[model samples]
Structure formats: C-alpha cells, structure tokens
Target chain A: MISPELQAHLQSVIPSSSRAALRTSVLPALLTGVARVASTLRAAQHVSLAGTANAFGDDQLNVDVAAEKDIRAALAACGTVVTASSEEDPVEKPVVHQDGITKGESQETYTLAFDPLDGSSIIAPNWSVGAIFGVWDGESALHQDPKTRQVVSILGVFGPRTTAIVAVRTDDAPPACFEVGFGDQGKQTWELMRAHVQLSRPPFKARYFAPANLRSAGEDARYMALVTHYISERYNLRYSGGLVPDVAHALTKGHGVYVNPVTAGSRAKLRKLYELFPVALVVECAGGRAVDPATGEDLLARPLEEWDERAGLVCGTAEEVDLVKEKLLG
Target chain B: MISPELQAHLQSVIPSSSRAALRTSVLPALLTGVARVASTLRAAQHVSLAGTANAFGDDQLNVDVAAEKDIRAALAACGTVVTASSEEDPVEKPVVHQDGITKGESQETYTLAFDPLDGSSIIAPNWSVGAIFGVWDGESALHQDPKTRQVVSILGVFGPRTTAIVAVRTDDAPPACFEVGFGDQGKQTWELMRAHVQLSRPPFKARYFAPANLRSAGEDARYMALVTHYISERYNLRYSGGLVPDVAHALTKGHGVYVNPVTAGSRAKLRKLYELFPVALVVECAGGRAVDPATGEDLLARPLEEWDERAGLVCGTAEEVDLVKEKLLG
Candidate 1:
C-alpha cells in the first residue's frame, strides 16, 4: 500500500544478514542527521554568519557551521559513523561517541562526506537550498579516490516541506530512489517515487544551468556559443542558482541537461568527491549518463584522483549528454 | 511588538466608514479565495484538469480549471463581489450570488480579476507557481480600460508554504505590503515582512529573468543585445519560467530585474488586466518601478485601454528599469 519505504528498500537489496544492520543502524543515523539539518534550515531567516571563509573561499554563514555541528552531533549519537567530513572541515575526523571515539575499528563502520548546507548564498532571498551527503560503508581510506570506496548511499534534502531524495545501492546493483516528506500527521514518512527512473533526451529543449559568472575571457566562449545556439533553437532556460533543485528538476522532468564544464574562461566548478560523485552516480543509476569532459568518459569510470581538483560534469539523458560532448566539448 | 497586520494597515489608510467595509467584506473574501486556491494548488500533483485550453491558446491543465472554480465558489459565498473574471474564462462575467444576481449597483461592490494558476505549465515539474488577484472597489465597468478602475488591493499566493503577499492602498496613499502564513492552530496570521520596502540600485550584479523562446526572427534583437550586454557585465540569470515567484524573488532579495517585453519579433505576452496591472502596481509600491514599452511611461500611469491588448513590462529598481529603457527600448 505504502510501497516499500526507503529503509525497507535498502533491506531488500542487501544480504539478509546485513539488512538489519542498515535498517537499524547506518540509514537511521543518516536520516536523523538530515532531518535535524532540515529543521535548522527551515528557520533560515534567523541564521547568523560566522564571519569565516569556508575551504572553498566562500564565506561560512553561521547556519552552515550550525548545520554541520548538528549533523555531526546527530551522527555521533547513532554510534554507527566512524568518520565524517564536510566542505567546512579541512580533513576527515573520527566521530566521537559517548563510549569512545571511532577509529574505524568495526567492519560496520561508515564514513560520511557532506555539504551541510549547499547553496547557502540564496537562503536570505527565500530561494530553495539543500543539504547533500554521501556515505560509504566500512572506512577503507577516508580520503582515497572516490572509486576506491565508492559511496553506497546518497541523499539530497530540499528545505521546503522537508522533502528528501534518497538513493541506496547494495552489492553490485543500480541505486534505488525513494522520497521522504512530512505527512499530514507531521510525521516523516517515505515513499518510493522511482524504482529506476530513466531519462529520455530526445526532443530536448536545451534547458540547462551554468554558473552565472563565467570568466569574461576564456575558452568558455564555445560553451557560451552552445548556450546561444540552444536559445536560438528555443530551449526554455530553467536555472535556479542551486544544484540540488536544478538536478532534481532534470530528473523529475525526465529530460534536459546540466553541466559544469572546464573552459579557458572558467575552471570546472564542481569538485569530484564532495559534489559530483554522488550526483553523477544518482543520475547514472536513474538511466541517465554522467560524463567527465577531460577524459570524455563516464564520470563514474574511476575514483577521483585529486580530491580538490576541479571536475567537469555533463548529465542528463544519453542523447543530451552526447550532444554536449559533440556540440560543446567536441 | 508585532508590526501592524495588513488589515490594520489597510484601515489606517482609509476613512473610518469605508475601513470597516473593506476590513469586514472585500478583503476577507479575497483572502479566503486566495487561501482556498492556495490549498488546492499546494498538492498540484493531484489536481485533475478538464484538459481544456485557456484564452491564451496555451493548453489548460485540470488544475487551472479547478482553481478557478474554487476561487469563484469562495467569492460567491462572500456576497461582496459584483463581477469577476479569470484567465481560464474567455470573458469577464457578473458574479451571481446567494442573495440574488445583482449588477454593480452598490458602491461597496468590488470587481475581481485573477489568474487562478499563473505559470501552471511548470507545475508538473515541481516548479513554484502562484495565484494572483487584483480587486477594484466599485466596478464602473468590468473589463474596461485598466486605467479606468485601478486595483486597490493585489494578492500573490506562493503555494509552497501557503505564503500570501497582500498589498492594499486607500485614500490615495502609497500601498503597504504584508505577508500571511498559517500560524499555530492552523489559523491564517499576517506578518509585515516589508514596511514600505524600497529598491536601492548599486553595485549591481545582474540577477534577472526574461522568458526564453523569443520569436527568432522578431524585432527583439535589441532586447537580446541588451541581455548579452548584461551577461558581459556579469549579471546572473535566475529564471524559473514562473513569473510570481520570479518577481517575488527580486522583491524579497531587494535587487534584480524581471522583464516581459514586446519586440518586433513578438507582441506583448502578458495580459494588461489579469497579469501586468497587479504585478506592476506591487513592484512600484515596493520602491521599484514598472514601465510600459509602448507608452514609455509608468505602467500604472493610466488604465490599459484594451482588456486583451498585450502589454510589455519592465520592473526592478528605478535605475535598472531606466537602463532597460535607455539600452533596449532606446
């Protein structure tokens, strides 16, 4: 009747032995962390700034710091996370618990990398912003290439209505997507929005998003030309200056493309591990494609060799991503 | 202490005799209609459309037809409206009430014009869409020149959080804006987010929205050139293909511009009565400016002489509007 809940779906995909482990331990902690962060962001009008710049040279709004702390505290309470890192932190740190700090001792130990509050810049203007997280089971090497310890789970939380897009993969299966929202009873409930939602790119309208401030002088002129061409072809422009919602729109609508490409005019903006890996995995699992411009290969083909290196990403239906390769990157 | 409620603000600006009339009659009915429509639209996922086409030749989703019915039904119960019209309906029609079908006889009778679901096309994709309404007290003639019966009250309802923006004016005073949302006990309550908010143009980072798909061979080349110039100036594009939320973002952010212009390539797209008049009035009241291209004057300088005439609008800080006039329209 309710279809399989996200937790139930996670259980169904895993070996029976580890099903309870995920259902009772790791997923609950991750969900709790997201909910707490969502509650904090709901009252964003009152959030203050810490007056410090984040690792990315973006000012760390006070809300970002608070959300990170809240997520960390929530995860620590669940006692399943061995390590955690965020865009605000310089390096991965052990999750300290009441019993003791986790040193990656247990086989069930999990690691989390997150952007506690993505798109913080647009919060004051009542724009939709989100929190994104990626989780790995068993801490192999906290900062290794994403391929080395590929994330088993990914989460995107859009603040309004506390809506969540959660996807989980097990063993060697494609990721299964589920949605969570507050029910009429004011309780958090999950529903399966898509089992394997795929993209169909034919008859593409050229809807896309590029960062507003592209370098005035650079190889980006080709990218600009592609945008102009798309406009001339009558593609509707639907960018919101937010990654989570923009990507979600593409998925929900089942078409269109989103790119963060490297050019002479602008360095690739999305980072491989913190941002693109989880997003790319979700898009690919949903029957879409995610490509890296540098190698002209699938973005998920390998673990990111450089943690801080800029990564170009093109994602959508196979046709759309292919067109980006041919028209924009070729 | 809480700032004055929208109703109280409305009372302060009007004569004592008419203040109660507006407070007890017209405003409540308008607010109720908006709330009913907003509640209906919040779950746009479930709305069943009649599968008809609206007057604009755009396909009408079932939600549009349903919202129009809901709003009309709510208004019919209030017994204060003399005439009403909606975008889904082909023409302005008299409101037949429970007491009896009375023409525009009493001075207290008001006329309502609304777009029951603006930007309904984007609803399926989870984009923010809104309901807009404008009220004119004492309907001299329905669907006449927009200049003849200027709207005294305008409402924009963003369905996500049941947020309503109400602007009211009386006795030739500048309009006051207030925000309404559901409070404890699920009762609608009002808060003043901006008391006489004004736009200050400086250090402009271009954040703007102009609908894509401009007629390819139309006289709009100069407008396109101005957009290119803005991009060169590093203005950020933030269009959601929805007008109410797009314009609301510009107001709430206190910066940015929103334009719906007519060029040789295309006629004015927004309707003078249902869309532009209310939006232009709100933008102007909020310390911003709204201009009509054909007349090269303030949008509200006079009533639109034709109900069905296409109208071009440019709204933002005075400086930005002036720049638009000088650069594109010049």
Candidate 2:
C-alpha cells in the first residue's frame, strides 16, 4: 500500500519538468516494488549456510541469492528501469518493458546499482540486515557521477520495522532524505514517518562511533590511533558487523561516524558500486559527508569502479568525517 | 494465532510437576500477553524525547514510560503474576487477580522483574531495541540467587521480526532455550522458528564482539587492552548500542561476547536486578556465560539488588566470556 502522501512528496521534491512522469509512473513503481521486497525480507528467518558461492569468495547464503533474484525480478516487473547490477551478480543487466501495452507518458529511464543483501556476513545473527539500492538516470552507472545523476537512494532496513532511509536528489532542488515504513507486517501499505532527516555531529549529544574493519588496525598505525582517539573522546560504540545498519544508525541517530579505512595492508572488502555508492548517496542526502577515507574526496564525485571494486569509506556527520580523514589518513 | 506447536513445546520443556498448570494456564497467558506487547512495539516508530527521568537520573523517553505501563497492564490482565518489578519504576508492584470467575485449578504464582525498554538510548536512531524479563516462582526476588529462583526468561526482541529468546530453566530436566516469532505484523499469532539456540566461541567461525560502555576504556587500561586484543584477534565487530539486541544477537548467531566492565573511574550503569539478571538467564540458558566483570562471579549466583543497583556484566559464549574476564578483569 503505497501512500498517496508519499506520491505527493515525490511531486514536490522532483523537478517539475519531469514531475508528471516520475510522480505518476517511475518513482511509485520503484517505491512499491522495494517496499514489497523489504516486506519479504522481513518475514524471512534465513540461516542456511550451504549455498553456491558468488563471484566473490564469500559463500552466498540462501537468503542472499533469494534477495538478488527478488530484486532483479522486481526491477524487471517495474519495466521503468533501464538497467540493474547487484552485489551477488555484479554484471549490469537490462530491464525490459513489461508494461508494453499499458505504457504511459515518456519519463527518464533509471539505471540501478544495488546490493540486494548488504550484510550477509552478519545475517546469520538474526540481528538487523538490509538492502541498498542506488538509482541513476540513463542506461548505465559505469562512469556517471553519483551526485549529479544519482536520482535516489533507497536503504531498506530489516530492523524492528521494515523501514527505509530514502533520498531523492534533483538538480534544481536540494536532496531530500526521509525515513519511511512499510505498513503493517504482511501488509503492503507504506507510510511516511520522518519528513526530514539529518546527522548529529559535534556539540550534539548524539555522538557515537562505528569502527569497521578493526582488524586493519593491526597493520595500520593510523587506524589504531584513530580508534584510540575515538575511545579517549568517549564516542559511544555502535559497530554492528552489518554495513546498512551501521551507516543508517548514524543517520537515524543524527550523529556518529561509520569509518572503514582501507590501508595498503588492510585491502578493501566493500564493493564501491553496490555497497558504498548507494550508502554514500543516502548519507550525503541526509546532510552528511560520504568521502573516500584516504583523500577525503566526495565519494559520489569519484568515478565508480568497473567490476566489484572494494574500498574504504568515511560517512556520517560532516564534521566527524573530516576528523576521521585528518586523523586516519594522516 | 498462537500456534499449538509452541504450546506443545512449552509442555515438553517445563517440569512435569508444574507442566499442566503452566501449559494450560500461567505460561500461555503470559506468552500471549508478551506476544501482543511485542507486536505493539514493532508497529511503533518511537522518537519522542520529552519524558520524566527514571531513578538513575537518565532522561526517560515517553516510549519508555509507556512500555512500563503497557507491561504492567498486560501482567495485571494476565492475573497469574503475583508480583512484578520494572526498570523505569523499580518498585515491586502487586498485580490484582482479574480472572476471579474463570480461575483455573491450582498453579504456581510467579514473580517478575523486567526492563520494559532496554535500549532506549539507541532508540532515537530507529535502530533495534528490546524487552528483558526474569520470572521467579516465589513471591519476592530480594536476596534470592537468580540461577535457582529464576524459572524463565523472556527476551522480547523488537527487530524486523517480533521475536523472542525464551528460556525455561527447570531443575528436573535440562533447561531449554528456543527462538520464537510473533506471527505476521498486525496479527496476534505466534510461531516457533528455532528449537535450540547455542553460542559459538573459540572453535566456531561466528566470533563477534559487542563492546558496550567503551567510554570506560579511557579510565580503565584493562578494558583498553581487551579492545586491542579483540582487534588483533580479528573478532568480527557487532556492537549495537542496545543490550537486548546485543545479547540476543549472541543467542541467535550462536556466537559473540558482549562485555561491559565497571572500573574505579568508570561506574556501573546497568541495573543488576532487571537488566543483568534477565539477560544472564537467557545467555546461560543458551549455554553461554554471564558474569561480573570484576570478580568473574556467575552473575546469576549473585543476589538481586533491592533498588536499581548498577553493575558491569560480561555475557555470551563460554570461551569468549572467560577470555574477556581474564583480559579485562586482570
């Protein structure tokens, strides 16, 4: 049950030139589709350890494969999406026009990069798992600058509630980030929960820290130093092994830093195109900073890696990211 | 929709002597009551900040107060609970018998202590929160060691799924801990998801860390050393700021250690009667260890604190808990 209220919100946030097509056709199709996926993921209790390995060495859980297949099938059903690529299957695949006979007025096509299950390593815990999707205009997401072309970021959280931290970015207006919930369990209805979302930084009580890849501290002195700094600073610790929840925690708390540094010895484990891009889009839209840990360059501004490239990221409150960059990279 | 399957399970695990009464009357009513409460909590999107402060001087949220009230009302309505205590309002309150005309045959009266909302500090983030309850057969919890007196522990988790880690500790037979789910959202049904839950420790690949109260590390060198040890040992990190989820994660994931130490400079913040006792019951029932971080005493062996006495706890996989105790308490 997609809400008319959210449809109205899409109208206000999207540029007026494409309002008619996007509001009525494109975004609604995607929102409803993702909501359904979130619902399906929520109802599941996934624990099977015997599943085929993906292109990566990580063994794909049954739920991971199912999520990817579900997202692909969902995107295909929408017909508005031009292309999609997922973490389990990173190759870009095209979406067909399923609503051929019922097609409406012309609208910009969307190329989506998604991690159907962002935190499979942490999934078995029956803790909170999530789905991350990045929406861009045109046929491909290969070299596009995420900041300009990335139209939306849908972060589906499978926590107590099937909630999402969604962002709508338009060239004319500022990017909008809101928290929305899928209606009652087993129901398809969607409701707009928080109208606006922002990150809490210094001088605010919402301060916390999510230190990912702590193993890297053994190899990188700077990573160790930064962690020591956070401890000494008394940053409340909140590092769930899952990526979506870690970043989303900072956003919902309106404070904190999700810092995963990739030093030479550490090497990167999180794929840039699927995991980082979508998360960074959502973070930046929430008035936070999503930057490369080493150079502090805006991650969305950097050209995405071609095939399953992994890297480090610093995202959350703008000030905290800056502090991480200064201390971690130095 | 309470499944006949779980009710059947209740009968099998509960001691045969009290089986009929507990299965037919007391436990069912309590389980149903908690299921409804979990459902109500899952549906809510709590962010209200204005509320009264609890005895601990921490600002309580409206949701916190409401949860306490709801649990009290539910317990009163159940009519089998003779006495109860709560974290928000730590006083022991007597529950009035409501089923006078419909009262069943002889059954044991139960006493309960609960932290209705355990992770309110992390609630603003829209992250996972939980409910912890400890049940005793006798009238009072004062001076009694939780291990023998604590008959059951209901660890209600408000995650994507309305779930619980329920432990029924019986002296006559082996204690049983199982994971159960509340039926679909908006439905009052219940389902048993997992029959057995055990923790993963040294020999398992599911090792993880949930470092609560890292603020104490600045004042305590032992804690800082423990953190460094975890990083170097490459334990996967998973410390959400919520206790219910953190402890529940260990039970669900079959691994992980949630260590919070109270030092000379860093005072304890978790209440022993409600928070630690309830959580310890669940952890121990899952074959894990729950202990005082300082003396390494079995936490369940300690007597209940009359008021909301705060202390440190180290809980989870047996090997991990022992490792934490040696490293952090040394």
Best by TM-score: 2
lDDT of each: 0.63, 0.75
Model 1 clashing-pair count: 15
Identify the leading candidate in terms of DockQ: 2
TM-score of decoy 2 = 0.93
lDDT of 1 at A236: 59
Please state the Cα-based DockQ of model 2 relative to the true two-chain complex: 0.56
